[model samples]
Target chain A: MKNLARYIITRLLLTIPMVFILLSIVFVVLRVMPGDPVSSMLGGHAPERVIEQKKEELGLNRPLSIQYLDYLWQICRLDLGESMVFKQRVTKAIAEKLPATIELTIFGILITLFLGVFLGAYAADRRRTVQDYVIRLYGIVVYCIPVYWMGLMLQLIFGIWLDILPISGRTSPRVFASTFEKTGLYIIDTILVRDFSALGDVLIHLVLPAFTLGLVLSGIFVRLTRANMLDVLRADYIIAAEARGIRHKKIVYKHALKNAFIPILTMMGLQIALLMAGAVLTETTFSWPGMGRLLLERIYLRDYPTIQGVIIMIALIVAMASLVVDIIYAIVDPRVRY
Target chain B: MATILEIEDLSVHFPIHIGTVRAVEDVSLNLEEGEVMGLVGESGCGKTTLGFSILRLLRPPGRIVKGRILYHGQDIVQMSEKEILSLRGRKIAMIFQDPLTSLNPLFRIDQQFIETLLTHEKGLHKRAAFTRAGNMLESLGISPERLLEYPHQMSGGMRQRIMIGMGLILSPDLLIADEPTTSLDVIVEAQFLDLLNDLRKQFNLTIILITHNLGNVAQLADRITVMYGGTIAEVGEANAIFDNPLHPYTQGLLSSIPNIKLDKPKLKTMPGSPPDLVNPPSGCVFHPRCPYAKDICKVQKPETFSKDGRLVSCWLYG
Candidate 1:
């Protein structure tokens, strides 16, 4: 317990500087870009008084160093400022949308983990056989198909053709009133109160979009698992395990699969970040109303606060994903620990 | 005496795109209960191939065309994969040649040993598994604390000892020690051999000691088989093979062993390389390098003949 505490503290301390460096780079790069945030907000034909007022309001009239210090101060104070388009606090907007994006990413990742490792190992265990070829084909086919194309195809077939699931939006309007009254994240409060009907509604709404997102990411996991599991199976220790009269399934799962997880685990955090990047396409198509689709909308209106806010959030997420991955890697493989 | 493992006419051949390469050909040997048999040959002489074939680990390309690997009178080639796996650690086990490669370096010794134990003994919880693993390590002359150390943390000698201990932990009826101590230093090698000698007696283990070191073969193996060009050139008691080797290849191999005797002449190497498996010599594979080669020797292959209770495949014996 003490060791774990110390380890977490070390990780947290290390992450502070890393996050600062990332934020500094993002701030500098955005500043050097060929546009004035003030002018971009106001139309070019805006009166000079309006422009001056906008510049003063945004605190853009200060020196570069003072602006950076001011940005750092806002960040330290947790005052992310207000969104240009929504006219709401950036943090409030993100907090409202963050849950939806997280829910999608988590469901997608869980599906990928369960199916990818299972199929990869199964294929490796039966190398050069028909099953191996079939799984390899599946991996290749899914990997080659872009997520956007696949998401549309799924919506067409499953939503339009079958009508078994919701075509767009996060939840059904019928149940949205009675079932989930609190947080818009219908899945959680439903499960928290053991409301099966509400839970089913949430799940019914979740499957198509989550499955679409998961199906895309699972290809990478399957290939990684197949490659890593095959390598581990060839290791002498696995042969030794088999020689010891261990059942074949145990050898594949416990011996081969666990050893294969180091590589898989390293990719998992990256996959979370990738899923967020991918969610934009998914949300736009599905009309899920997550930050991804919202960000896209802000991009069109040239909403500086919303655009910069979303980008900063995305950067923070990517950085945090990597930090979490490194920490987990150290935990799982003690050899990697400092 | 009951034979623990017997391989008859076991041949492993690899069919290439262009030609078929024979790796182990027409080789036969037997290991009695508690007997240590040494298989001595140069690299690529099919020693390890023979070991893997017994385990039925030969994947594609290298097919066992005609062979009968009879472990206690049951043909292993006919056994299903599950049956073979059942026999692997319970009845037969193999210690790989390179200790570094044998162990998965990513795992700690305790994790690997415990996993090995749990694989054989079902439902053995982690505590019991750890206890057994630690005890096995201690029995192999390793300190129990070394169980926590990773494979990299241990010395070559320690790793080799751990490998032997892994093979012995199951107390299999037959243990195939394939060049068990080949990668260690001379002193470590001798210590490792001695450790194996002690463990074999303790567990009544039937061992097949595979190596190219004639000196170690002489000290360790109860019986010896001299392999050349993927076939057994000579098979006999170690003393008999060392003293009265009948085949020319065996004679050449013995003559090449350097003796440190003060008055004796220095050793000499055999002439020419081993016969290529892809295109082996038609008649006697060793005829090109044989000092007593004749017109018949180049045209006619040698036949196995029994002499003094040992098998020798040489025209001179014929």
Candidate 2:
């Protein structure tokens, strides 16, 4: 327990400097860009007096060092300043959009975990056979595909041609208000409200986008799971297990898969962070109102603080995911706590 | 003697990128019930392969080509997957050389023991399995509390003892101990051997002790089978093998050991290595290595001859 506490403290302390460094980079890059936030946001039609007033309000009139320091201080207090694009607090804007990206990733990772491990075990068991070859080929094909193109194709087939699923957005505008009452997550909020019809509509909209993202991600899981499972299956303990008259299913699932899962879990956190980044392209293709799509919009409006806020938020999430992975790794193996 | 396992014309071949290596050749041996049989050979001579084939534990790329491992008159090679699954570790258990690698690194001693029990005997409760596992460990000199400890937490000798505990937990009919004491120190090795002897008698276990050390074999084995280049060179009572080894390969192996009984000027050593299985010598596999190799020994494979309850596969013996 002492070791675990020590490990957690050390990780959290280390993450502080890393997050600061990433934020500093995002801050400087946004400011150093060709355009100024006030000018780009107000546009040429705005009067010079209005632009000056807007610059003062946003603290652009302050010296560059002071502005940077003020920005850092606000961020330290969990404040992301204001979004010129949304005319609201950057953090609030982010909070509103975050749930969608998370919802997509939750589905993606679930699919990845389920398929990665299952197919991986199947491939290892049927190694060098025709089934193994076909799985390998399938994994390769899925891994190399452009997720955006896959999403469009899914939308084309399931949404337009078949007309079975929703092509875009979180839910129908009529049902969206009902989902907003409980949790920000549409599916959960729908359940909380007992709005079964709205829940069905939300799920219908989610299917194509989630399927596209999940399928693309599943390829990596398949390869990683297969490779690790193969290695673990060859381990002496596995041989020992086989010699002990342990049924094949028990040996593979209980012994081999559990051991193999460690490496996959270690990689999962980093992949989740990457998935957040990937949601940019995925959300754009499907027109989902997630943080990635919001960030794109703020970038067009040259809303510097919101862009900086979004990047910092992503970095924070990545750091938190890494911490979660470390905690999970310690839980699974215990040795990592030391 | 009542026969327990009869391995007839058993051959195991491993296919590599270059060619197939005939790891275990046409070898026939009979194992009697509750006897300690020593299978001795140098490294890469397929002694391990032969031991594994007994339990059908041999993995792929290496497979039994032509064989009948008759366990109580039932050919194990011909047994279905289900039959073999039920046989291994329940009917016949195996203990490997390096105990550290042999036990799962990730699992606790109790977890391994309990899981092994529950795997073979379904509907066995976890608590019941755990109790059985703890009792088994306590009997083996490991405290029941230590059952929760991982395999790495224990010493090599302790781990080996734990392995032994696991092997005996189900009361298997046969035990294939492949160099079970090779990793331990001399002191630990002696203690482990003694424990094995005691356990064998207690369980009435039929143990096939596969090893290269003649000393270990002499201490435990009642009968001996000396393998060379994937074939049995000699098979006889342990006393006859040590007293008057017939085959050139057996004789060479016996001489190579530094006999402290007589103060030898220097330790004797075999001149050439074991033959390559891909393309062994045209006649006898041991011809090149055998000092007694004659013209006929280089051209035609020798036939086995039985004399006075001993079998020797050599032209010189003929």
Candidate 3:
């Protein structure tokens, strides 16, 4: 337990430098990009003097080193500065939009795990059969399809032709207007307010985007899970378990799957970054009111603070997620020491 | 003593893309109750496959193609999945060659032992199962407290002892040990054999000890069965087989054992590697390497002949 705590602390400390590097990169990339907030905001038709005045007011006219240090200092104090596009603090904008993205991501991960793990294990258990081949093909084909393309295809099918689900937006306007927002996450707020119909509405709106993001990424998991399951199934202990007369289900799920899960868990941590990347495309495609959509709009409007802030938040989350995975790995696998 | 196991015309084959690898072929053997049978063979000679087949635990691609494994008059080959599940830990158990790999690393020692006990004894409480496992471990000279530790925490010898304890906890009628001490050091191997012998007597276990080590067989086996190229070469009482190995293959195996008593010992190795199961030699499997190979040995497979109250499969026996 003590070792785990120390490990977590060390892991967390290590992320600081990683975040710093990412922040520096974001800072450099945003600065070196061709667009200026003042010109982009004014549609590039404003007089030079007016643009210069606006740039001065925004502190962009300062020296590069000074601006960089100032940006870092502001971030150190937990201030992400005001978004040129939203006319609000970048931190507040992110906090508002983050919960929706998080909700979508949570659902996406759940779906990914459900589809990937079970299908993968099924394929492994029934290896060399028709089902295994089908699943293997599914894993490969799904991963090959681009996330945005899949989202559009799903939208076309489920939204237009089927017309069963809403293709765009998070919730129906009626539910959005009536439900009192408490947590910023529409699903939870609906549940907390005891609004079942509103909850249904929110979920109905969520299915297309979340599924789009989840299905595309689940392919990696399926392949990973199947490969790991095959390896674990061949382990001597699995044979030993069979020899002990343990039921086939227990051996497959408990013994083989448990061992296979360590590597899968590690992969899952890495997948968070991929999931976040996928969320950006899914959110923009669906016009869902989430961080990804917000980041896209801000980038178009040359909202430097908002873009840098969103990327920094994502990098931190990815780092923290991997750390959590390492801790869980150590807990689950006895051989893993600090 | 009653016949505890009867394997009649057993043939285990692994069919791959190229061809079927005949791992065990038409080998007939029976075990008397409370007897230790040493199954000796070179690597890839089907000794381990035979051991696994008794429990009907051969994985995919490797299967019992033609055979009847009768455990106390019940055909294991025909047993349903549920029936076999019940028969496995309750009636027959197995210990593998590498103890480290045989035990699940994630589970504590007690969990592995208790799982076996609980699997066979359905109504047994978890606490009672733990107590039983701890007692079993104590008998094997392992501390009961160490049951909480993972398999990796223990040394190879200790882990092997735990495996033995688990195999016996259900008091199975037959125990198949496949190269159980192959992974242990020399000193540990000696200690393990002694422990196994004492346990065999105490529990009256009927074990099929599979190994290439003739020395281990010499220590504990009452009856010895020598296998070569997926076929049984010879079977007889340990003392008789040791004193006068009838089959040429047996003679070569016995001579290959280094005699330390000689002033300058010459270690004799068999001329060629064990035959590939995928493309085994046609006639007598051992004839290619047999010192006294003849034209008949190349064309016709030898038949098992009863001579002096023992079975020898060689043209020479004819």
True contacts kept of each: 0.46, 0.74, 0.88
Report backbone clashes per prediction: 0, 0, 0
**How much lDDT does candidate 3 score?**
0.91
> Tens digit of lDDT per residue, candidate 3, span A41-128?
8877898899888998889999999999998999889788888765798889989899989999999999999999999998999999
Name the regions of candidate 2 deviating beyond 4 angstroms.
Answer: A45-50, B259-265
lDDT tens per residue, model 3, B151-206: 98999999999988888898887889999999999999999999988988898889
Chain A vs. true chain A, TM-score per candidate? 0.87, 0.93, 0.97
Cα misplacement distance, residue A218 of candidate 2 (Å): 2.0
lDDT of 1 by residue, A1-338 (tens): 57666866776677667656776886776667666656666767889999888778777787989988877787778677786545688888888787788788788888888888889989988898999999988988887878788889988998989988886877777775345546756687787778878788778878877887888888888899999998998887776666566677987887788789999998887787778878998888888878998888766665555666777787677767776777777766656745
Q: Better model by lDDT, 1 or 3?
A: 3
Pairs that collide in candidate 1 are none
- What are the DockQ scores of the candidates, in order? 0.49, 0.74, 0.88
Q: What is the C-alpha lDDT of each candidate?
A: 0.81, 0.87, 0.91
Give the Cα-based TM-score of candidate 1 against the true structure. Answer: 0.90
Query: Candidate 1's interface RMSD, please?
Result: 2.2
